[model samples]
Target: MRVLLTGGAGYIGSHTAVNLISDGNKVLLYDNLSNSDASVINGIAAITGVKPTLIKGDVLDEIGLVNAIEKFKPDAVIHFAGLKSVKESSLKPLEYYSTNVGGIVTLLRAMLKTGVNNVVFSSSATVYDSRQKMPVDENGIVGNAANPYGETKIICEKILADIWRRYSLNVTILRYFNPIGAHPSAMIGENPVYPNNLAPYITEVALGKREYLGVFGNDYPTVDGTGVRDYIHVCDLAEGHSLALKNMDGLKVYNLGTGKGSSVLEVLRAFCNVEERDIPYRIMPRREGDVAELVACCDKAKKELGFAPVYNLTDMARSCLAYARKNFSGKIK
Candidate 1:
């Protein structure tokens, strides 16, 4: 199969491209490089020995998407593009809406013009605002998220659902819980444009990029009193995308997560264990849109999409540590 991956140069998309190419599929990467690097293309080529065709353009541009579809004629499109920072989205709502929401409209329009019907989207776990639940499932009440970034995901899911219902498009929406870790090879992995997510922050602290890990909400209801979340490995998440593409019918949404919650203190402890160093920290107040705990029930994905997380916390920590140790030094950026 040939795939056109929007945001392909980004963390998950690039890793998925690696897996897809290894599986004897051709991949074309579509990215504007807003948050990812062009050097990643070289890294992918280094690892896989096959460079995915890349188009440098925004998803909002119709001409570029149409041209990409016509030239590539991909069997499916896996979209990983858009602004992802929860805090930033809260600050600049319109930019988030334009890039995240408007970008989808452009992709769909280009797909419609090019007669491409299959799509695999990168959705979010934020859709399920499960305050009382431990492991979030697809059937749970999808309460309105506390921020614009999550709301965009909710809105995109609805748009995809409506399109699938009306046009009979094959759409698979994968709701990602906190994705951490790197590739086992350490050749390619998560590279954030900004410091926002947990794993990266921990990585920075361990590398002395910052002074301490901010233990948000140390008074939560969890065993450790810190907020808990399901941190799935990036490879596992990449493999899940491959599983999603295997099916090309109707509408299916799956939760890609570890199914177990790890608190901020637990993450810090795990980093200490893995790196064999104490990470300095403080118990800061929880952010505005932050939650106390959220894991995932991935049984549906396991049963239907043949998806299951294979990497453990140790594996996750090791990979992330490897990447951070080599790439991020306190002196660099």
Candidate 2:
């Protein structure tokens, strides 16, 4: 199958590109290089021995998207391009809406023009309201997102649903948990530019870029008294996309995660064990909108898409450390 991946040069998209190409599929990467680098294409080639065709463009550009869709004529599109920062989105809500929501509008318009109906959207677990029960599933209520970033994701999911209902479009929505780790090759990984996620911040501390890791709220109701989250390896997340593409028809939703939770201290200890070095840290107040636990009930994905995470926490930590040590020079970019 021929696939076009928006944000294909980004962390998860790049990994997905390799997985798709390795499975005997043709992939064309379209990215704006906003939060990703073009050199990731080379890294993907290095890992998969096949370089995906790349078109430098944004999802908001209807003309560019139409041209690319008509030219590549992809069998499906895995949409992964958007601004994705919870705190930043609160400060810049308009920018988040304009880019994320507006981008989808333009992309859908172009896809309609080109008659490309299959779409796999990159949604988030953030769409699940904090007040919902633990182990969020596809059937969880999706309003009251904690931040604007999550709001945009909910809005996008609604937009996809509406399109599916009105146009009979094929849409698959994959709600991802905390994705960590890198490609085992150590060639490409999460971006260091303004690192916002826990894994990247832990990597920075491991590489001596940061003085200490902040343990947020050590009093939460969990095994270790810290917040618990489902951390899925990026490679596994990539594979889920491939499976979604195969089974995507009408509107379907799945949670891509390990179905297990790890606490903040547990994650820190895992990274330390992988690096074989002590990482300094101090307990800090829990940030706003943080829940005591957020794991996944991945039964739907497992039963329907045959999706299961292959990498454990140690694997996630080791691969992340390898990527950081190789790509970073103790500089916090």
Candidate 3:
């Protein structure tokens, strides 16, 4: 299949590009490099032995998007372009809505013009209400997202559903859980411009870049009093995208994550075990919009798309630390 990935140079998009090319698919990358580095294209080529066709453009640029689609003539698209920081979203909700929500509007308009109907959207587990049942399923209620970042995801999902009903567009929404870890080759990993998530922050602490890890809220109703989440390997999440593209027909949704939950303290311990260094941390007040536990019930994805996680917490810790070491030592660009 010939596919075009928006934001293809970013963390998850770069890993997904490698997976797609490894599976014998031609890929064209469209990105503006706002939150990602252009050097990542070289890493993708080093791993996959094939350089993807890249168009340096933003998702909100309708004319550029239409031209790229017309030129590449992709059979499908995996949309991943947007601002993705929950804390940042709370600060700049308008920017999040303008980019995350408006970008999709422009992309779909371009797709309609170019007759590209198939799309695999990158959704998030944050769309689920915090008070919903544990291990959220596809049938769970949406629209009660905790933060503006999650609210954008909920809005995007609704827009896609409406577009599917009106235009018969083929859409597959993959709601991802907490994605950690790096590629086994240490070629590409989660290197955000500004670290916000737990894994990246933990890695910063391990590398001595940060003084200490902040354990947000040890009073939560969890096993260790810290927040718990389903941490899935980035490779596994990338593979699920490929499978969704292969089996997608009309509008469908699936949660991509491990069925089990891991507490923040447990994750810190796993990293310490792998790196052989103790990470100092202090418990702080819980941030707003955080839930006690947010895990996925992935039985729907397992039965429908044949998706299952192959890596555990230990594997995640090892790969993440390895990637940080390589990146810090200038082994990987």
lDDT per residue, candidate 1, 1-333, as tens digits?
989999999989899999999889999999999889888888789889998788998999999999989999988999999999887888999999898889888999999899999999999988887575668788887867878998999999999999899888999999999888898888888887876788888888788777888876777788888888899999999999998999767998899997998888887788899988788998888777777788999999999888888998878888998887766654544
| Model 2 weakest 10-residue run by lDDT | 324-333
TM-score of model 1 (CA atoms): 0.97
Model 3, span 225-317: residue lDDT tens: 999999999999999999998997999999999989999999999999998878999999988767788999999999999998899999999
| Residue pairs that clash (backbone atoms under 3 angstroms), model 3 | none
- Decoy 2 TM-score against native: 0.96
Pairs of colliding residues, candidate 1: none
Whose lDDT is greatest here? 3
State every prediction's TM-score relative to the real structure.
0.97, 0.96, 0.97
Error of 3 at 159 (Å): 0.5
Off by over 4 Å in 3: 330-333
Taking all chains together, the TM-score of candidate 3 against the true structure is: 0.97
Q: Model 1, poorest ten-residue lDDT window? A: 324-333
2 or 3, greater by lDDT? 3
The global C-alpha lDDT for each of the candidates, from Candidate 1 onward, is 0.88, 0.90, 0.92
Question: Model 1: residues >4 Å from true position, as ranges?
Answer: 329-333
